[model samples]
Target: MSYLMMFYSAFFSTSVSASETAATANPMRSQVVADLVEFLIEAGQYLGMKLEQGSMSYQLFALGSIFLVAFASFILAKLILHFKVLRLVSRSNNTWDDCLMEAGVFRRIARIVPGIVVYTTYSLFFEPEDKLYSLLANFSAIYLLFTAWRTLSGSLTAIENIYSRSLLAKKAPITGFIQVTKLLLTLVLIFLLLSLLLGKSPIYLLSGLTAIAAVLLLIFRDTILGFVAGIQIAANRMFNTGDWIAMPKYEVDGEILEIGLNVVKVQNWDKTISTLPTYSLTTDAVKNWRGMTESGGRRIKRSVYLDIHSVSFADAELLEEWEGMKLLNQYLKDKKQELVEDRKLKEIEETDILNCRRLTNLGTFRAYLTSYLKKHEMINQDLTCMVRQLKPTEIGIPLEIYCFSKEKNWVAYEQIQADIFDHVLAILPVFKLRAYQRVSSHNEQAQKNAQ
Candidate 1:
């Protein structure tokens, strides 16, 4: 292009001199000179010419140089990523890169070098106005953006893994928060790409969103609600991953498996999974077994019916007999002495049982139950342990045993409860008390035959 520049300079100088000295300078001469230079340059380009023709074969040398540079860059990046950086990362005990590997972070990052090579070399191969160069550059940019996105996603996943492995993360999970941040990052990247492609300011596009705020809210209502609820749950320590919770509204009676932005997953005892909206945990009433679990006890609240007819005041003979029984010996002795002293002090008639506070067989049974529970190895003595009688119904008097069992496991707790009831049922007759039962036809027939 230097030869053309020299020829144009001389031609333009001559034209200026002729215009100063002559009546008219020929515009056709200037036009002809310009056209001849343009033709020569075009002919040289078609013949694969260079400014210094003998210095190097332009196309061959330029193409080879571009290829070599691109190939070298690719090899260097590959070597750095695979043989050097990744190998070093793999050897380290730190789990951060291990998580990255698991999440495919390095693999995504490895694409960046090749993408840069293609982007740089494509421009060297074709002119700026060429469609092929533009297409290649655009594709390279897209690939680079995609790789960046993938790396970002994988890095976020790696961060989540790292957080989950931490002690604090186990106690207060940040999975939902991490996920929401990832989603926001993804959206921002998408907007940035659009802005880049449209050659418009991102701020301008964002400002346009003011009119669609309501639509955005509607679209992300659940996510927004769940994000708020997740924060509340974590900050308040309302629930944890392993907490056994029951939400009848959602049919979830199970241990919490995961809490996410939009949903909470539960794995039930029956091996069924139940998913509940994250906001439901904050807004709705759900039973958390955390209290019971933390207390190290499982409650046993059940009752056995006592036949009303079998309940009677214990006479001296019956009291003496109970005093000989090992389990009730000390209790009966103490009560009998108390009763005798009370009767003597009140000057009550000994034969008139209603005149004194005499212990009934049912009362003795209740006392026995309280003592039994207190002495039980499987019962939690630190809590409210009691044996009380509920109001009598037509069936009988409900003798309720309210206590906490040592075992929290369902099977073990049930066994312990059953064992206590079994002993109670078996020993009831020893106190001259009978458990209430519906009279059957066989018993009626036997009584009639006896009569």
Candidate 2:
């Protein structure tokens, strides 16, 4: 306890001497604080306590006081911002202010208050020649720089939030660009921070770092590529969020969730997440279904095989039966009239069915399918709707139905396509045509036994 008292006496005496000198040399130093220190030292000495002047303890005390003042100032700033600034922001009807607050822009801005306080008042606690003063000044500058970085970063976040609500965001997402800007800002901050810590100019450090440019390139190869690719993507307006992209090479087929600086996130149809480097979007061959989506229709290109043996000329009875059908009524009338004119033009007799331009059952079936698609509610009539026959394969003749569906949704499109094919297959027997199917051994044996 006695040693502690002596230490206090010596510390106060040193503080008093240093404060007096500081007050005389620097007009900005607080005279009242210096007088308080002097009075404490004089009172302790008058009470028969041994005292000394100008000790290392005084410098330590001044440095400690500067840090203490900075801490207290930070708390006070927070209290003021919470009660005054934050309340005002919250009560306002502005959406921008709300975004800024939510992103902590104001909070991060308030962080500089302590650094400012320390910077402005450091001289009051230490002289111009004091090493502690230089140290505090450098520290406060770095602190302010960091606070500025945080505030700016938060502001960028707020900007992104504001942009996300706009209609254009869906078509032209700026996330990659924003991330690139943030990365550049972070690099600048790092350089500045390094300059301050090393007591060197940023230009000098940048020049020195040029020697390691190759090493830096190797380290940030992906980042550089992504940055370049991001620029290309934005400039070209290739794809955006919610666009369905298929990259078979990567086994990725999904909607884009996010386009970031390093990677793009995809939410697959199966609810699984896929991540690919942003550069890959530029380098890779990806199919964007946005055109199909924007066209408001999805194509259905599928073929149904038919037994070639079932293809025969339409006889009189079959022609009469198809003529009565409502869907084929007008079609048959036009065809019969055209056939009569054609047979007259070529001087061919109707009794000579082999030489006449008569319609085959396969051709009639194809015509019926075309008319059915034209009248179907789900098929888009404005687009190319066709039923064409392809070359015969070993299996059968390929009768392909190519059309766009009114319903572009996957499930709805599938249902529409299934309904069309179901109707076609069921009505095939009416035309006396068979959908070709490979006969299984069991069916062949059963047929033989039945015969």
Candidate 3:
């Protein structure tokens, strides 16, 4: 095969010079020259031309040589993959190489063996001047580019998966960044491949991109915005995977499952997924419940209205009754003594109910609520806990309970709130305070029957 390739190279060199001299000496002989060359070539080939004379036999030998080289390279590559490289890669603890193997990066590199053999043997089958050799070389280059692209892309995806599962990734995720890098790499490779196909320098082709920069930006506006937003989100710690966020503008109220370059996926409380543009998080309002979850308690703010007619100064009988109640015994006794002494010192008439500082049922009920919350096991004592009155309305007086529940979980917190309210409602009558309710037909009918 080597001898045939050498002979063909020598013969083509001499024949090209001879044809050039013949054409220059007699221009009209060019057609006759081509025909004579073809006849001699066909006749010599039929006559069983030998390698010793550098004839068409050498061309057949060269063609056979190329096929043999290709076959040998393929077998060698397969053997290397099976017995040598893949096993070694798979045995290592370093998963990057394993990923490469799984993604066929190694296999793609192995293909280079066959490609090199084919390229080196290409000249054996045909002269450099032949159009087929040039076409084959071009096609091979294109195929090589495609193989490299596939290998790189697959390896990137594998790497991304591995990295996304790592400890560092848990604290600071970079999946979006990695994906963007892969996309840019692909674009660069595509541009290089295009330059090779056009027989132009990559720089020359890239220079034209400057002119279309605006158009490119317009086409990829969303992607650009998302990329920027992703950076901002990461740097600011605005949101992360598994964060509960509520965005009313996009109707997304859920935990963020993924943050991508162009979109953020949220798994709603109902288990439905909502896709939101990445930029929207930066530009619009979103409520992140991470703070609440991290806090010691969950806020509880609620109001209970009291009937105005149910409120009155605590008289001796009522005070004595309240004193018997263990929860408010000390408070009632102290207040009653203080009121009596103040009235006597100020020389105010004891019969005048409004003349001195006196405990009202509504005020006592508010105090009871505050004390109850402070002692409640589910309420966080470390945080502010207050039971106070808001401005009275036409229906009644507004008693607002402001406190924090110790439990932060949704269900537990709700249960605690319900229990607290239940106790408060039940004990309201004990304080001689009635929850405001509209007069109904039942009350009117009972009153008429009694009359």
The best candidate by TM-score is: 2
Tens-place lDDT digits, model 3, residues 156-240: 8778767766775645556668668877867866775676577665557767989999999999999999999989887887887
Total backbone clashes of candidate 2, pairs 3 or more residues apart or in separate chains: 0
Please identify which of the two predictions, 1 or 3, would achieve the higher lDDT against the true structure.
1
lDDT of 3: 0.75
* TM-scores for all predictions: 0.79, 0.85, 0.73
Poorest lDDT segment (10 consecutive residues) of candidate 3: 7-16
- Runs in model 2 with CA error above 4 Å? 1-65, 128-131, 440-451
Tens digits of lDDT, candidate 1, 82-102: 888788887999988788888
Clashes of each: 0, 0, 0
Clashing pairs in 3: none
TM-score ranking from best candidate downward: 2, 1, 3
The per-residue C-alpha lDDT of model 2 at residue 424 equals 88
Error of 2 at 13 (Å): 32
RMSD of each: 11.7, 8.5, 9.8
